[model samples]
Structure formats: C-alpha cells, structure tokens
Target: SDTLTDQQKKCVAPNVYSLAQAYLNSEQAWPRAIYLGETPIGFIMLDIDPEDIDKKENAYYLWRFMIARDYQGKGYGKKALDLIIDKCKEDQKSVLYTSCDMEEEMPYRFYMNYGFTDTGVFDDDEKVLKLQLI
Candidate 1:
C-alpha cells in the first residue's frame, strides 16, 4: 500500500491512495484487484458515476490503475483493462475518461493502444483521454 510515489518507482498513485479514495467515494467507485491465478498483481479503480466526481458530464472514469513493476509488460495490464471496459459496458456506460502525465513512465501509450483518444483537455497537468464503450 504505497502512496503516490512509492520508492519513486511509478507515476501513478499506488493502491493505498487509490483504494482510500475509492473507499471515501464509495457511492461512485468500483475498485477491483487484478489477479494472476490467486496472486494479486495490480489494482484498478473506476468512478462509475463520474458526474458525481470531478467529471462535468455523465460517464465512467478510469480513476486509477497500476501493475507492480515485476508484472509489467506481460499482458496483465491489457487484460485488466479489458475487464474494466467490460464492466462499464455491463453497467450501460457509453464513455470512459482518464488522464495521464506526459512522463515516460505514464500509461499514455498503453491507453492509446486500447483505443483511448485524447480529449485535448487537462485534468491538472495530466492530458485527458476518452474511449467510447457503447
């Protein structure tokens, strides 16, 4: 349960911050543990009701996502994202939004490869990306 910059390893906030935010925003959060067999490899949290959060419109938001360094580049992230998308579709959501830093360690390209397009907006300094789920 590391904070935002645990050991200066990754750009994304660690599970501790994400999960804590999820707990505090329980009414709109949908946090899940990404597992490999029985072992937890990463964490993802979605703001299912984004309009209630920082979003200005009604949509789903990819609040936080990260896989441990040892588990990176092994298809775990893609699989976890697929599951997140499926969950949103299941709930009748049409759009999903997320933002990422321009830094090399960020998931910008990862999300782009998954069909997320830049919204030409910024959530703080993070560039916003969006995907259509419907």
Candidate 2:
C-alpha cells in the first residue's frame, strides 16, 4: 500500500494511514497483509462487526484494499478480494460496503465487476458500492 503508483494513491490510502486508523477503531477495523508465500503482496482493511448476525447495512465494509504496483494485473487483487468476501461470510455478514472515488483510475469498475453495485450513497466525495452476499 505504501509503494503504489501516484494514480493508485489517489484511489486508496497508504497502509500506514489505514493501520493508524485501525488503531483508533481496533474493535471494528481489521487490517491484514496479502501475502504470497513469504512475500507481502498487498494490504487489506475491513470495517466489520463480527457479531452482526442481524446483518445491518453498516455491519461490514471493505475499508481499504491495495495491491502493490508490481503486484497489480497479476491476478492478486481479485484473489485477495475473494478472501475478504469469505471473511465477511464467516462473520455472518450479508452485505459488504465499499466506497471509491469516481475517477477513471479508481476501483469502481473492479468492484462492480466483482458484483458490487452502486448504492446511491457517498462518503464525502467517494461513492459507495454494495455487494449482497449469499
């Protein structure tokens, strides 16, 4: 997350920023590395309520996710996201929310391609997307 391109930086915040935020909300923000064998390939952060059996709309969020510059386009992003989706299912979450800038370089299409739909919501200037999970 730290070594992303300038274009990518405009989309996702640095891992340090996400980690510090995670520190502030340790109960809800979950941060982890996307590792390939012994190497760290990416970073992911989730804002989730593991106890949300009722599956509220705000119960789960894909807070931050990024693949390193060199790691992008190598199938790591989708694979890492699958892991995140699995985690949400394990936590009994029925919906996953995420926000992205509306820029062309942003990850709106990627999330949409993965079944996330626009929710007509915005977190500041970022547009929110939702995925309904089975």
Candidate 3:
C-alpha cells in the first residue's frame, strides 16, 4: 500500500485491504503478492465468478494487478504478467479477462502492450480487455 502514491492509490485500491475484503467475500477470488526474491513488490488477484462458468468461453479474470510505483518500468510487471499467463495456460484456460479504468494511463497501455484487446465491455466505468491464451 505504501508503494503507491496518492494518485496511484486513487486509480487502484490498496492491495492488502482489497485482498482481505475479496477473500472475506468470496472463495473464488485468488490474491497473490508479487515478490522479487525476498522483497514484496506488488499484488495481483484473479477471480472466477459463477457467472463466468456459464460463459461459452472458459476464462478467468485478472481481477486486480498493480506494480509498486518504484517498481514500475523495471520489467517486473511484464515478467509477472507472463507468469500469470503461464498459470492460466497450465489450467487450460483459453482466455484471460481484465478491466481497467480508461483514464488510468499505466494499466491501459500496459495491458494493451501485453496483448490484451479491448472487448467493448465495461464494468463500473472500466474498459474490459481480453487475451486469447490458446
């Protein structure tokens, strides 16, 4: 939480607090801390909602992701994302979904560069994006 600035915090929720709330609310949410060696650097969450199970395409959402301000631009975010994609592939997931505030420059561009395409879907004012894993 202290890794982000006030502006960044506004764009993304505090990781520790959000993770606690997510776990308390649903067993489907999986949260993980991003670590480099022994140092904590960021956080990510993946969710597989019941509604997602009903979809024709099998996918999981990249529910939340944030790299610390100091850690940004160091290639850690990209490497972490690659690991997440690999995990989904191992689980036989064909697609990975995520949504980000359109106004948030970092996440919007980062996801795009990482091959997530806009899906023309929105949730709570955020633009949805999807990556085809297969």
Candidate 4:
C-alpha cells in the first residue's frame, strides 16, 4: 500500500487492506514482493489452478502486479517481468498468461519482448498474452 499514491488507493478502495492481509495469508497463491535494489517496489501474485495441477497442464496466471509510479520507467518493469518468468519456470508451469490494457503500450511491449503472444482479448479494450514454457 505504501507504493500506491493517494489516487491509486481510491481506485482500489476499501478492499486494499483486507486484500493485502488476505493475500499475505494465502500460501497457495504464492505472491512475491519485487524490489528495486534494496527498496521494496511492488508485488506480483501467481496462482496455479488446482484441477489442472494433477494433469500438469496449468497456466501460471499473474493475478496482481504493480510497480510504484516512481519506478515505472528506467527498466524496472522488464526486470520485474523477468523475475516472474524465472519464478514460473521454477514452478514448472507449462505456460503463463496476463492481460494488459491496450492503452498501456509498455506492458504490451514488455510481454511481447519476453516472448508472450496475444492469445485472447476481452471487451476489445485489453489483450491477453501467453507464453508457453514448453
């Protein structure tokens, strides 16, 4: 929450503290904290579907991700994304998926640069990118 600006806090609303507390308590979700050197920068939440686990065909999904506004540029997003890839690969996930707003060109390009391809789109305003680990 410290990373969020006042306006960002409003957008997320009342659930901010509750969600953060709940997320911290959930081991299955496997949330990770991202840091820029020694300063904590953001959080990434990764989840694997329980049903798909038995077949080893799950897609690792990024549930939440945010980097402080001050950390937006200067290559931090790419480094954070690389961390996601490394974490997912370590978990043996067959693929990973994430959605980005069309207006946010950075995230779209970031996913593309990391070898993620557009696999689906929702509401014609966002794109879903997938990276097959296999």
Candidate 5:
C-alpha cells in the first residue's frame, strides 16, 4: 500500500494494533497518533522534559509530528497542535518546542504562524522552533 512500504508494514503491524496500549503504558515518553474515526490521521511523539536534547531554558520537545498524505491541507495539523498546546497548558508546562525540515515550506510557516520562534537549525536540514506559554 502507498501508506506503508512492505518492510514498514511488516515492522509496524503489531505496533499498530497495540498503539494505544503502548502509548498509555509507556514510562519514558508519549508517542501517539490522532485519528479521524477509525482512520489514523497523524502521529505525535513528545517528551515532557527530555534529557540530553539541548534547548533554551525551560523548554520541552514535541519530537515528531506528521500528518498522513490524505489528511494534509485539511487543517487537522493545526487542530492536533491545538490539542497538544491545550494539554500542555492544563499541565502548567511553560514552553514547547519542535524541529522541522527546513526544506519543507508548509510546516516551517505553520509553526511560525502558530507562534513558534525560530531558535536555530540542526541535523543539517532541520530548523528548531520554540513557543513560550503564558
């Protein structure tokens, strides 16, 4: 299937079925996907206070976030971000940060529009951004 390559399909089959259980049971970090009805729309893996990942003072990482091809351009990305931000606010977290490939125009602008400031670049092609919550 175009959604997943053969090797990826095989590798992720079990994890897909146990996604929720794994996410909820995880002791280290949050790795989750957002769904629309029964369809998986996107995934977000984050850490509340990750160690070793260098960041500005008082910031946490929203490590990975990706919307599926069919779900792109539908504003679901913004909604997912809103959900995450709301959760952070509820938990009294002060700052949130993420990194995106600089070559990708949409995500870079999206983060900027949503109030993230470009802090620096890393991984040769990724730009890091930050948002401070009040």
Candidate 6:
C-alpha cells in the first residue's frame, strides 16, 4: 500500500499509521493490503466487534479503506470493496459496518453506491453505515 501524504491523510480517516498501530494492538482488528496483480494500490482494515463475537448477530466493520491518490477513480476501490464483502460473507457475518466523515463526499458516496445504508448512528463525528449480508 502506498504511504499517504499529509493532505491525503486528512481525507481518509485514521491514516495508514494509525491503522497499522490498531492492527498491532487489537486482537479484533485485521489489516490487509490491496493489490492489482503484484502492485500494491491500497489498504483495508477489518474489525470484528469483540462484544458481538458470541452474539447471534455479529458486526464486522470495514474499519478503514484507502486507495493511492494516483489509483483513485480507476475502479480499484469498488473492486477491492467487492472482494472484502465476499470475504465477509464467507465468514458468515450478518452485516458489515463502517463510518465516514460526513464532509467527505467521495467516500460517503462510494460506500452508499456499494449498498451501505445510513444506520442513524454516529461515532464521534463520523456517520455510521451498514451493509446487510444476510
């Protein structure tokens, strides 16, 4: 995955460094690199809510997703998300959750177009959205 510039970090929540730290520190969080053949283009972070682990309904979160600036608008993000959804389905998760800055138009629209609906929940200033898989 490409390193985010300071300006790009402002757009994507919890920048790459933070995501890496979270993956290292939390048992529930996992991070994966997005690649196109052999080239790395982006990164994704997944999180399973520890509180919901034993519950009948588990919430798998798309904690962070970001494409390299040069890689944006090339359909990589959509394809990467589709692959992530497939993985979630294979895991038998009922839904996938994510949050985005309300002010960031691109990401907000991207997630909505991919079937994530607003859940009327807010985590700090971010708007929460969920995609039902079952």
Model 6 stretches astray by more than 4 angstroms: 1-8, 13-16, 50-54
Score every model by TM-score: 0.86, 0.89, 0.90, 0.70, 0.74, 0.83
Error of 3 at 28 (Å): 0.4
Which sections of candidate 4 miss by over 4 Å?
1-18, 21-27, 50-56, 104-106, 123-125
CA lDDT, candidate 2, residue 31 = 96
> Tens digits of per-residue lDDT for model 5 on 6-118?
43333223335445544764664677778998988777767766674554455557866666667777898899999999888887778887877655365788889989999
Q: Which is the leading candidate under TM-score? A: 3
Error at 93, model 3, angstroms? 0.3
Clashing pairs in 5: none
Q: In model 1, how large is the Cα lDDT of residue 41? A: 84
Better of 5 and 6 by TM-score: 6
**What is the Å distance of residue 86 in model 1 from its true position?**
0.7
Which stretches in model 1 have alpha-carbon errors above 4 Å?
Answer: 1-10, 52-58
The TM-score-based order of candidates, best leading, equals 3, 2, 1, 6, 5, 4
Please list the C-alpha lDDT of all candidates, in the order they appear: 0.80, 0.83, 0.84, 0.66, 0.70, 0.79
Clashing pairs in 2: none
Better of 2 and 5 by TM-score: 2
lDDT of 1 by residue, 1-134 (tens): 44234533445776778888888989988999888999988888888877634554547889888887778888989999998888888877778899888787458889898899998988889889989777
Question: Which sections of candidate 5 miss by over 4 Å?
Answer: 4-25, 53-56, 121-124
- Separate clash counts for every candidate: 0, 0, 0, 0, 0, 0
Q: Supply the global lDDT for candidate 6.
A: 0.79
lDDT of the structure predicted as candidate 4? 0.66
Clash count (model 5, backbone only): 0
Of 4 and 5, the candidate ahead on lDDT is 5
**lDDT-superior candidate, 4 or 6:** 6
